[model samples]
Target: MTALPQERRIVTAIPGPKSQELQARRTAAVAQGVGSVLPVFTARAGGGIIEDVDGNRLIDFGSGIAVTSVGASAEAVVRRAAAQLADFTHTCFMVTPYEGYVEVAEALAELTPGDHAKKSALFNSGAEAVENAVKVARAHTKRQAVVVFDHGYHGRTNLTMALTSKNMPYKHGFGPFAPEVYRVPVAYGYRWPTGPQNAGPEAAAQAIDQITKQVGPDNVAAIIIEPLLGEGGFIEPAKGFLPAIRDFAAANGIVFVADEIQSGFCRTGQWFACEDEGIVPDLITTAKGIAGGLPLAAVTGRAEIMDAAHAGGLGGTYGGNPVACAGALGAIETMRDLDLNARAKAIEVTMKARLTAMAEKFEVIGDVRGRGAMIAIELVKDRTTKEPAPEATAALAKACHQEGLLVLTCGTYGNVLRFLPPLVIGEDLLNEGLDIIEQAFARI
Candidate 1:
């Protein structure tokens, strides 16, 4: 089979002849509720690029929202998955335990931070992993309250929806959310109430104090946060803040949860984003990009805490499917063999240099921040006022899309453009994507 870039061929309009034909059939034959990110339809993808039904091959900077970090159609993942399929598909780990499932859990135990004894439970999606993490925390602490940060995104399930910060799109009509969920302010230095450049320990301290007084430390179960907020603009916390929160959770007998669903698997140049702060969480929830695009989410934590869940309460029908486990095993191996951590770091190096130059050249480029392959640029009206320029963001994204680059925009205000290129992306392709970004910004 030909690998991802089979050869760039944009023979027709962006959506092309075939895609337009499919779109008509899609609206009539497919569910009316089906949604799409772009007007073009994908026919194939691989190694940091996606080919549309129209045959227009575009450099993929989004990576399916940071899911295919090892690259789509990864050699090992494809081979291992096919090998497993030849054996059997489903046995249901809960019904009849499988070696692959146990093996994946064992690998997670060894890979997750902390040399202390640990255990892991696998689920089918990031939301399930997040829900299970809460179950573990609640069972371990015997508490009722769960704390989530402002502008932080956990998942889409009912409980996670309550845990999420955004109101529209995620929680607009979804109401009567799970009870006992509390919202707290995250340390977003850029948009902190204190001031853009002034966010620091003081803001973190203030949020901590409020939670302590209102929620009561004794009643709180877990304080879950994204080490680097993913869906909430990819905003990394200010220094001293994560360490401080760690100390607080420890002192209060509350479990600290790090939601690394979008930042794990060497995506952020580290095994886990929390590693950046030298802080180990009590429970870590991960998914997206794990298992090389296969469905697998995990909750890895201190053994005692993970074991607190009732024996029958921690499983799912499709959790740890054998084929998915095989894919995960291969994905992890591929990541290590490729030395993707070093590659992610190299991407950061190049992006910083080029994007910094763009920042100096463009007045609308307000702030650029992120780690490794997960970098982003915040658009603004002016450097002095710092008003979010969402309009410019839309224009820039449209320009990039029209020019054969796949980019994604995020942030609470929808003004941040994020880059999540696969770790296996070629340096030439990576720079080409960045060049497209520069050109897009220049046009804007």
Candidate 2:
């Protein structure tokens, strides 16, 4: 196939006639609860642009929620996945193991943090990996209680729904969630009542105290967290907070798991977000960008902990699908060859500079926080009051959509604008996306 022009071009309305028609068919067929940010359907996507059915190219700042870090159609990813597709699709790893699955496990062992011997099990999604991580943690420690943080998003499954903090969309009506999971306060610097400077130590102390008194340290099996909170407005925990938490888990023998599904695979300027503070987790769950858009997830951790499960205790029918494994390998190769880690850092610098300036100019931008390419701007009705501006966020997102720029809004309060452009996106397209954001915010 030939290359796309690699520029944003609006030949029709945001949702042109073709897309509008498709949207009608979608409404008739798809469920009402399943939400989509934009009405336009994608025809093709690569690099930083998504070509819609109407033949309009929109600058992609979402990267499919950070799944396409190497771009939607990177050469290596497509080549390997296609080759695997042609060769054979599946022979369930549980029944008949394949080299691709083992290779992915080996790569994850080497790529994740720490020098200790590690092991991994593949799955179909981030939530599955997280649930498995919890399983292994419980099996290893022989404990039942699990700990999670405020505003955290693990997944939509029953057990993961309990692990997740937000409720409106993920867990509003889903009732009778798993029982052993516990919730605690996170070091959300912007919203911490005591102020950001003291958030780290105070929040850590609060969480530990709660766990000790309520759940009891002896019963706690694991503590899972997003080093950089994703759907929770991309809040980076206050300095020392993560290290303190990790140390606490270690001292108590509770397995520490880092949910890097959205923050890993070089999206955070590091191989994993846990590395920002030199923190090492007992286990790490990863997905999204791991396979360059393919569906794959993994639970990697210390060999002993990972091996604690019985022979038949873990795995799924489609876990580590050959094609997805191949895609993951290709994605890893792209990250190494393209040096996407450095690219992510550069993206952080450019975006922070631009967003910080925007915040200075606009009082609605209450906080601009996040590391590397996974950045966000939280909108507020007033900086002093810090009231969430969900309406303004909706308006801004609509404005960008009309202008042919694809952006995503997230946050527990639904007041944040997140940007996650593919690592291979050109500087010009990245800047153009930012320009659209600035202009859209100005209109708002």
Candidate 3:
């Protein structure tokens, strides 16, 4: 919408003079702990392209880490959000309620899985939504333990960091996380000790056994998971695995929570990834992609469970800011009007075909997995042993960046190259980004 050319063009180097200057200023001004994947300072971004301050137009394959599915500045989102900004910025929702927050909650109820009477409480971030979800589950079930899985990534908050399995960057120095969080094995098909065919049942059995024997199922308040693992390699759980876990949670009266922060809102070809298996979660946490780049998150679930918390138990000062709610409403409107679910499915078909072909050609590509636009390739040194090629993954990402294509790498081992192009990206731009990736592969 910003009239910026929807094509990749490298004017100077990757971090041109202006960007380098900003990077120097950033080093002086910004905190050392705040990490930036790319140092280029953006002037404007829209429709799969980010124009940096130096006039370099880079093809955006990351979509701001999947937050801009309708593009960074969709017409509807910009218009509605602008209108709301003119009207009011924030009323602190708790102090003075607004219609926009209620509208967003209504939208979430309709869009998120489950037909049962549902209610939603909005928050400012995915981590906060997850934290509240755990709180609500504990309030409803009256239990203390929460179960997560290996390689899972929740967020940077203390409770979420404990729920998260990765240790280095997310949890290294942050110590003394919240107690009563338990980790179990996930049905990681590619890296499972047993074969993929048996991975689902075996992993489910082991997790259930762990909960029953070690954590004690009766003490478990909830079992939270990403239907399609997000920062954990974009790994889709093996077939039957989610259903088995869901059934176990139901039997044990443990709330089943789906953290759809990364995999929700049409990124996974479905409104939510859990819908792929028709597994309706008792509580679902959502954020990223909900508000077209605005910070907003939510916990939507069964009415009874959601209502379990006391009146003063669940809200924050900035929760459900009216401007962000307006953006979410606009995003949902755009998603429906444009049919982004179909677009995501098409992206998957296109990307999988090309990536599958690349896997056939390149021995370094150990696995090509994920649904819809949220896909990834796990690089490895050897096919048989699956020794992670983290160095190669980093090299390939850097090469793509130099070629004016923005890509992101993620996974527990840091060897996964994830592709999360905007659902609105044109076929030509999408293929061009893939071409850049293939060329990077060739060079590596």
Best by lDDT: 3
lDDT of 3 by residue, 398-431 (tens): 9999999999999999999999998889899999
TM-score of 3: 0.99
The superposed Cα distance between candidate 2 and the true structure at residue 287, in angstroms, equals 0.6
Q: Number of backbone collisions per candidate, in order?
A: 0, 0, 0
Candidates ranked, most accurate by lDDT first: 3, 2, 1
How far off is residue 34 in model 3, in Å? Answer: 0.4
lDDT of 2 by residue, 323-415 (tens): 999999999999999999999999988999998999988899999889889999999998878899999999999999999998999999999
Q: lDDT of each prediction vs. the true structure?
A: 0.87, 0.94, 0.95
lDDT at 322, model 1: 92
Distance from true position, residue 306, model 1, in Å?
A: 0.5
- TM-score for each model: 0.97, 0.99, 0.99
